[model samples]
Target: MSRASARNVLLVEDDTAIATVIIAALEDEGFKIEHCTSVAARDGWLRGHAFDVMLTDVMLEDGDGLASLDSVRKAAPDMPVIVLSAQNTLDTAVRASDSDAFEYFPKPFDLDELVQAVQQACGGSGSSANLPDEPDDDGMPLVGRSQAMQSVYRMITRVLRNDLTVLVTGESGTGKELVAEAIHQLGSRRSGPFVAVNTAAIPADLIESELFGHEKGAFTGAVAQAIGKFEQANGGTLFLDEIGDMPAEAQTRLLRALQSGRIRRVGGRQEIAVDVRIVAATNRDLVPMISAGTFREDLYYRLNVVPIELPPLRDRREDIDVLCQHFLSQAVEEGLPRRQLSADALEKLRGRNWRGNVRELRNVVYRLALMARDDVIDPGSLADIIGDEQLPIGQSGDVRTSGIGQALETWLAAENPSAGSVYSQAIAAFEKPLIEHALGRTSGNQLRAAKLLGINRNTLRKRIGELGIEPDRFARPL
Candidate 1:
């Protein structure tokens, strides 16, 4: 029979409503639609007759849609299988593509486009060659298969369903703010604004004004009535980053805001009722700070209502390959040439102690894309960009020497003669360049730079003073 005259399609969908809608749409296009809700029925129907194309949901009551795809491909190798799923992510997209599926449609997709994709898979004149590409608007979501990240995803989904306060704790480069943004996106308040404030980045005197806003005459620089993050994020999410670095006064006021759901301007007495979900993040161990009396224990409990901990990248090395591919795809979407990592380069990445975690990996990949001359990224190219001295011992043949201890010893012997004073200078030298490098990377955005360096902005400021590095030097020119 001719191709157009014999277009038979099998659609496996668990939702009866969705199946009815899709079947009506496909049937209208002059193709026969055979519907099945379970894999057993789908297999039975496949055995009875040949199908030109197959459409299956990723999840069903009996089995996964990919399994159905496998069965169809085995029985009819030429038949095209399209996967429909609500769980839209890079990892899922890649999996579908690698499985030789013809296309993928994320949920809430346009019916017209899906029909067209089906047509194309069946070799129709107006059919698309591949599934509609995943949207490239946002940068890639955090991709991982490791248990650590899986747990993190689960906790984020659970916390996003409510307005309870959240505290995200992790090492500096572990993408704490990304977790907060994910929570906001997945929550009921997705349409609401997501306002973020870095407590440590603001000056101690100005923190109050920054968090609670200020009246026109609040202070010398307060020329107009300013709105704070709390007010701006009203009815949404307010992410307080580096909460541990907040000044005692600011901490007290923040506690009041969390407790009362209200705020008063710096120079105004009226307490304005506000509704905002609070998500706080910190690299510091709050338990220690609470014991030391620097952090309020009550505030800790309030913010820790739903605690989410992000494991450092080193702890989840299994995710490095997936993350690398995800980032490479991101770079390509951003107008850079697409590239793949060589096996050696990928192995090196897996072996490294990722102190900076995901953030550092992103930077490394971006740098490699810019510096690599060829389409494939080799180990040498990656090493050159991330610096060879930072490579793991087994790969580089160099003894592991990049640590605070080694830095301290070098500084003590070279710069300080008196043992008593050596400790201070050693600490300064070890910290100064790291802060400077992070500042340079972020163009002196103290908040982001502080997160990258794994130090509180207040501590960064103190070190800036001790190192005699002017903050203005690192500031970007407007």
Candidate 2:
């Protein structure tokens, strides 16, 4: 690029280390660099000079970077702004796009990519209509800075402007309802009431009346007219939780209402029009249910118009530290004394696999805040609390006995054995199921079962002999 036509780049960043690296790269590209450390300084510079492209950070010494970008948007609508943020949440990315910034870059960002964005931004273009950022006071309730959560945030933002039905799928305790509430709170119908009905919680006989309302004296117990969830959620969003558990009869009624955009009371004839956005969530796999003819395929199609899959906490270990801090802050606000987690304790938390996802983590944090004596939670304190908590397993087994420790404890509590033999008995009790499960999973192929068990085939064979496990029962017959 020639000096005469070289672009002017304004960088608003506070960290000197990051600024130095950015300035060196941009200056070497022949662009004139003007640095501003705070939003106040940036405003003054904006008043004095015209820049070809602007790069700003989310956090500055004086004010929030994303919030301040609105000024640049108004002052020089045509000058493209590239937002760099260390706050790599979905909210940050959405706010950047809403501000009409040319592009958004998460920190530890690739410099080569930033350069490309600046180069593209330098190409002159007129201002576009502005999208107002979400209110500062209304922070993102769902917390996670991982890339997985970022994808979820982007999806939430996309569907916020529309009334499209959304289906949120994740394991239990992954905050499915929270996602539903976020969409309702942030979407165009923020003022409307959000009514959530759990399909599984309601009895099968009452689901119809629970959702579609009923006329007075409609049934044996119907003394008065009842307004159902669909009508209650009028002009807003209706969240149907555990939708897979909705009985077949209720599923039919729901599908009909979704298709026609109208509903009739359980025992009344007049069709009532309901302008409700449906957001359904389920932990069960609807596809398999559809195949089994239990869950309605049509209803699945209707609610799945916009699908949001929330990742479980175990998959996003990067977020564990932040989540723990958030829960700890919450506990403090709710009357617990302020407490902090030691670095070692946080690392230990990050290393463990959370079966209950965010909910489980929150519970542990709350427990620690209330029970732990130390102001700073250390590994020892964390271990004592965590060790007492039972590790949950998959749906295939009973949770109480599924965990090795829990199973051993249950056995010892029941049997009065010689203290010496109790240890061996417990070991055998734990190993039996584990080896059986491995054999079952591998169809009794010793080599495959050994691999699954992470042990040598010979060791596995020896263990089978010692434990008296009948591997032949599980073996695939010739």
Candidate 3:
């Protein structure tokens, strides 16, 4: 290929020898390569030049490869990033893909296969600005295939035909943003920009500026005119994630904008009319918020015109195997040797209560892909990566002193329970030992214990109280 036509490749590898070899190979294949050893350097290079593809190592000296992948996707949505890792664990591969990696390859990969991946990525075989950085090999929908998810898909199809206000409610990590993307992709507004803003992530003081454009000198840091998400998403979908976290003042302003279909710049009186569809998502119960007077009832009703609730992963265990296989295929496409979960591993995955939902499962799978020694992952390997304390009851019974059967018996022995009491008891029994083990691992520091348990400190404390457990006994001596 001519120099003008050559694909630009950003090679991010710490190992100089490996980088040299890959650069030479890629050059031989008529591609231009720019090599960097860290995310910081890569970021600097990207600001000055654009690349068709990026090849990154997971454990960079300065930062993580996944973070770099996210940055690249955000800056250049169409560019493809392929992750390289020496660890080669299932989690690494799955995470790389889930983070929008175009592909993942273990260290010491075949040169020909790597070149092929680069070629396909650069050739735009599966390229789109809105397409996931990492494509799902199984072509499954972003969420589960449960009746709930099927209903979500059908609603999304219908909503895409018009610009309707969408309210998606679910627990965190239930893929609410994914649902928003689906609607945008299938809707008449496909050609318009899809802007997403998390109300919780932004500081309460600056939220109004984030949603409505600000004129230069509007605030201390307003050095230049800034267009907000609303203006950017005009004629498209503006996904307001964590809408429940929005402040009262911002909520009132947002409601007015929704009703009038217009927004005024923070420092200017000019009213800019926008034709945008608002899609808001939240994990909180808005009905309760409305009743409690924290959230406006009128705003809640406006946003909830088309309500969609995403079922948590626990409710759709039937789709576990399918999700696992889908992630595996994606891992293989990333360049790892193809892998599969053993029957025991699959059972372990299916039985777990994924509190973090699909996001957590994807992380577990990525870790397993990197750590498993064989093509078929086993329960032991899965437990090791997810940690013994976090493994499901059926998978790591040994980690808990109280056996699953014993815990179940004890829970069933409790009296005067409500309907689904058995299910509640079973869950507590399964979680109690794990929490105890995690506390043991962390020497009963509730904060660390919560991290080990993959939950918030407050939630962990609540569970400890509910289970009638004490931490002093398991705590290590200071």
How accurate locally is residue 292 in candidate 2, as Cα lDDT from 0 to 100? 96
Worst 10 residues of 2 by lDDT: 387-396
In model 1, the clashing pairs are 120-127
Q: Going through the candidates in order, what is the number of backbone clashes in each?
A: 1, 0, 16
Which of candidates 2 and 3 is the stronger one according to TM-score? Answer: 2
Q: Write the per-residue lDDT of candidate 2 for residues 366-476, one digit (tens) a residue.
A: 867865668998987775544523332334455443344343554466556666675785564456657877887788899999999899999999888665465866776
Model 1 lDDT per residue over 1-478, tens place: 2124448899989999889999888887878989989888988988888888989888898987774466766677777888887665544554465456676676756798788888888883212233233223354346776767756765664564468889999887788998888777656676789999988778899999988999998889788999998999998899999998899988899999889989999999899999999999998889988989999999899899999999999998988998898888888888877888999999988997665679878866865675466898787756544544443122343323333433344445565377666677544434554676677678878888878878798987787755545455557853
Distance (Å) between predicted and true CA of 56, model 2?
4.4
lDDT, model 3, position 224: 96
Which parts of model 1 have CA positions greater than 4 angstroms off? 1-140, 391-478
* Shift in Å, residue 150, candidate 3: 1.7
Top candidate (TM-score): 2
Give lDDT: candidate 1, residue 90: 43
